[model samples]
Target: MERSQPNYRLIYHDIISIKCPGKKEECSPILNKKEISILDVIKLNMIIFGINDKETQIFNQKHRSYDESTILEILDYQAKNNLNNTQLANHFKLSRNTVAKWKKHFKNKHLHPVKAN
Candidate 1:
């Protein structure tokens, strides 16, 4: 015997109900589950929550961008603690690529100053 996949349509409706509460008009009806992918559900949730790519980018810029000193501190911590890029990323709330970039910049002595937005 094998377990069956959960019905995504029901899950979508449940998410919509949770997001909209008692507002039936605000919730969009799912006409065809076959037409909906995980990405579609994600987009729907983003719309319901008033989140867009621009807003996400702005949020990331505000939170994720680090100053030169902070970047150096991250590199120092990584070296002293013998941590990997993933660990540094998790500790600093940054991506692995960011940690790798900082390491590369530190080595190359080309660490760019974080621009004020």
Candidate 2:
């Protein structure tokens, strides 16, 4: 029922398009799925830069949640950039405590980087 309704919100998606060798000229979506999580909805709704200070402060106050994969991706970014928890937090607008907690929780997990630009 939920999928039946139109999603008019400007939701962000990471669609992978590939043009197979000798297959076709046009690139096709390879891994686009219909289902998306609430975390995805909030996280993907990007806050644009150059906004007024008041708006920026208001946006920063909003609560955010990340799934396991996203957490792993953030950790991967931190590792790849050789950034400490505080630096990584600053980069991602996250609390250093949260980053530290994630590091401790997913220390043994495998890396699966999901690039979000």
Candidate 3:
């Protein structure tokens, strides 16, 4: 049986409050939210904290899933930036082997995109 896709929607409380000096302050529940893609989340992390080789190794220990669109975006970025497999892997904290496999897999799937398994 084929596996179902995972939910990538992430929600968090971004509460903003006002303070008063020695007076009963009034507060209201404000929901400030926006939908962000998982790829954007990963990009933000990389921007905020420059990932090192050790961190990349540790991150590689964890298994993460990416949809076809996301994979295509990554590969496109690699092409746009003129990055080799190793450089692209280091930038995204992915295994070089994984990058190579994705390149090979997608290249072969060009003619039969829907048949990628």
- Best-performing candidate as measured by TM-score: 3
Q: Model 1: how far is 80 from its true place, Å?
A: 1.1
Candidate 2 lDDT over 5-84, as tens digits, reads: 22413222222112223221221121133545443343333321224586775676465557777788778888777787
Tens digits of per-residue lDDT, candidate 1, 1-117, equal 976545766776776677665533444554254555433444455556765587785675455335565567567667677777888777655787877777767864533333211
Clashes per model (N, Cα, C within 3 A): 0, 0, 0
Give the lowest summed-lDDT range of ten residues in model 2.
22-31
For candidate 3, write residues 1-117 as lDDT tens digits.
Answer: 988543322221111112222221211111112444457545433443446687775865476677777777788778777788888888877888888888887874433232222
Give the whole-model CA lDDT for all candidates, comma-separated. 0.59, 0.54, 0.55
**Which pairs of residues have clashing backbones in candidate 2?**
none
TM-score of 1: 0.39
Better of 1 and 3 by lDDT: 1
The number of residue pairs in model 3 that clash at the backbone is 0
- What is the model-wide C-alpha lDDT for candidate 1? 0.59
- Winner on lDDT (2 vs 3): 3
